[model samples]
Target: MKGEPRLAELIASLSLATDLGLGLPQEHVLRQTVIAMRLAEAAGLDHAAQADTFYVSLLAWVGCIADSHELSRWFGDDRQIRADSYQVDKVGLPMMRLMLTHVGADAPPLRRITTIGRFLTGGFRDAVDGFVAHCQTTGDVADRLGMNARVKVALSQAFERWDGKGVPGTAGGEQIEAVMRVVQIADDAEVFCSTGGPDAAGVMLRSRRGSEFDPALVATCLAHSERIFSGLHEVDAWSLVIEACPDLDRPVRLAELDQMLEIFADYADLKSPWYLGHSRAVSALADAAAVEMSCSAADRALVRRAGLVHRLGATGVSTSIWNKPGRLSAAEQERVRQVPYFTERILSRQPTLAGIGSIAGMAFERSDGTGYPRGLRAAAIPVPARILAAAAAYQDLAEERPTRPALPFPQRRAALLADVDAGRLDAAAARAVLAAAGHAVGRRTRLVAGLTAREAEVLELLVRGLANKQIAARLSVTPRTVATHIEHVFTKTGVSTRGAAAMFALRHGLVDAGGTSAERPM
Candidate 1:
């Protein structure tokens, strides 16, 4: 634990969060990765193909985060949709039926009918668009993490099928990357095997062979089915994947560690469009507030890392709940409160990240024991965790939600102070966070990608899920003018979709991570 952590630990641990997001049991990805590796070995693939298969297996469905917002709109619970998707081949009428079954599942009768009508019109096209978004976002994240080109390319084809039925439908049969083919079988195999045993897994694999799965790989799986799944249920998938890390157990340096953590932050935030940049903003605010509080350098860094991952568990909850425009019912609120616990469980399995996980898990704990998951009182809450709680609160207030617009600085500040009065947040921590936000420093002066100030502003609102008319109204411009600005933004940034543009803004820090200073509040 004292030594630098290996890259495998980081990725393997993050895969746990991916499982939660996909509504699978923890270690589902790890189990699938192990299975994929076994299948790759059994197929007599070369070392390069084997290595690519290893990572592609772990990261295959991670792109699911990219289109969760759209999924939630079409299907009430994105996770449930994914969990159920394993039972069917996601192409043609079967795929369309699965989606229609879940459309507006939790909405009121009128809203549900309206949503169904919308889906009947153009929703399937939007669904295909989501797959495209997933591929690009996954490739971008792989590129940023310094994954090899083969790995990135394999990830880009994650949505493609052997039958040419996948989104983008650019590749089929042998044209699809072999590594992706391996993962396709292993991914669903793990689910079927886990639920109904290896016999069921074998049946499912053979059924989709040459269509959803590569025939050769499926044949290999059937030949070595017993060996491929041997001890899959008995062994600890996390430990197996970490020890068998194809990267030779290489450790990530401190700088690389921070960069990868930032990638995880972006991935977690991508769970919903409304959450775009939320983790980054909270991280920036927490780091700055820790400085204002006179914390030690190590503590400052710890809080910042914690802030970035504090919402990792947020993936466990459905966007239908997170995106709710009105007050939550008692049952819904209870489920949301478990987010921090999920975060802690995801990170705690990785030895080096466990400490950071503990701090992040306390992001919702209140000073007076009113907050959730643990509800520790003031004396038990450490200073850094307290600052994290306050930083997260402040950033949330500053961000636009479906229920309300971004709070003005004065109102946001007053809200924080009011939390202090209500004994929910630390008084000192709230003051430090307010001061840090009011006097935010070291923002990038020159915009990258040649975006004008207004273009950057439009990009921010666009990422926040605002329509052209809403953005125009907010900026006091016509919808056509906003459209022009958006087109310019897309051209300059080299991205054609709002999801990709949001990634650009977040990666380049063009959008405000926190509030701007109108006054130097103490």
Candidate 2:
């Protein structure tokens, strides 16, 4: 584990994409992280407080994607609204004005009026709760990544204002954590300076000194003046922040890998309530289908992890498109297509996770080569990749979408077969995935040559590309036990080596499960 990557590295890799979701350039979060460090020093925050400030600044806005679906539901261009919002203080009348301007800017008159009517009802309450959700979810991610207790608690209060006017305000003034106060200024200051230079940033912070920001911290930042505000444009933002990461970026426990991947799954699904369990469901099906296809244990886990993070790019796409009630224009359709590519680019930055990203990026490829991002042909795709693509399509077809209701399972199942017939999915991969979906599942009901029914099962898994060790793991047996079974299978079936045994099984129809239609999808 000496060269293994740390969890912070994973979080840092996603910092750029988080900025894109906020409608800022990739380095927005990184620059703010550096600025927060400077503010922490000037405020005389202790070592412990400084470390908390580092992560709090980097992740403050990373959870912005969680409200995208709801935000787009209430505002046509959620991304643009957020981008404009950074230009003003989010407290009191300015926040109300911002909401009024964006609520129905592009909607029809009737729709706009109805939106206002709903806003008067309970929609106002929901909007305030969205900020609470942001703070809660961000803390959840930090917790999942094993951050310190102080970081998690301060993060949960990130939106609490000095004047106690913020979401779920439980404390204010000095009671508000210093790290949150420092980050609030750093977060807004970066936006003003990057877009309007230091003078505009200075003026903006000065105006909100006590109401929206801690006055002392704001003064400290302004005092540093040239040291903190200058050269932001000249420095290498990404490398600087990575180097400045808190000293807690140590190697993760191997057992924590799935938990880390689950963090990605949770973060991606947070884009909308509609995506509630979308990634987890797909990951489960893909894992089961990998087992059905006898994919190696390593490959099975990899494919499942791919299913979880395949939608990482969904962060960059607006919820306007994801929650649209009707068809999309060509331009909108093109935007939806880049999601997987974004996922790949983000994951590829961390070398340890590059394999998962490689496979996850192909979750939409077609056998006929009509998929977006890359039109990979059938033979060009691997079995695990093909299973993932098929599984995701199946699940999406069975789930509700913005433009349509959930298709009946019969109809969804028919659509999957149609894709196989139309060359969009491989036949064997389709059947195996269908079996995983409970289409026609059963062990070999008959013997092959002189082999027992169970011996035939082992041979089928072998032919489908499992190694002895993987097969043993899947069966909960030792490799030596599997070796004994394989020898008996070879002698009984008049075959040696895995390929020949597989051919014999296929030729004899033992691997195809001729006895039962229950799970024989083909």
Clash count for each candidate, listed in order shown = 0, 4
Q: Candidate 1: where is the Cα deviation over 4 Å?
A: 441-446, 472-488, 513-522
- Residue-level lDDT tens digits of model 1 in 175-274: 9888888898999999999999999999999889988999989999999999999889899888888777785346887656677788878878877677
Scored by lDDT, the top model is: 1
Report the error of model 2 at residue 514, Å: 31
Global Cα RMSD, each model: 3.5, 15.8
Q: How far is candidate 2 from the true structure (C-alpha RMSD, Å)?
A: 15.8
TM-score of each: 0.93, 0.79
Whole-model Cα lDDT of every candidate shown, in order: 0.84, 0.76
Give lDDT: candidate 1, residue 154.
Answer: 86
* RMSD of model 1 against the true structure: 3.5
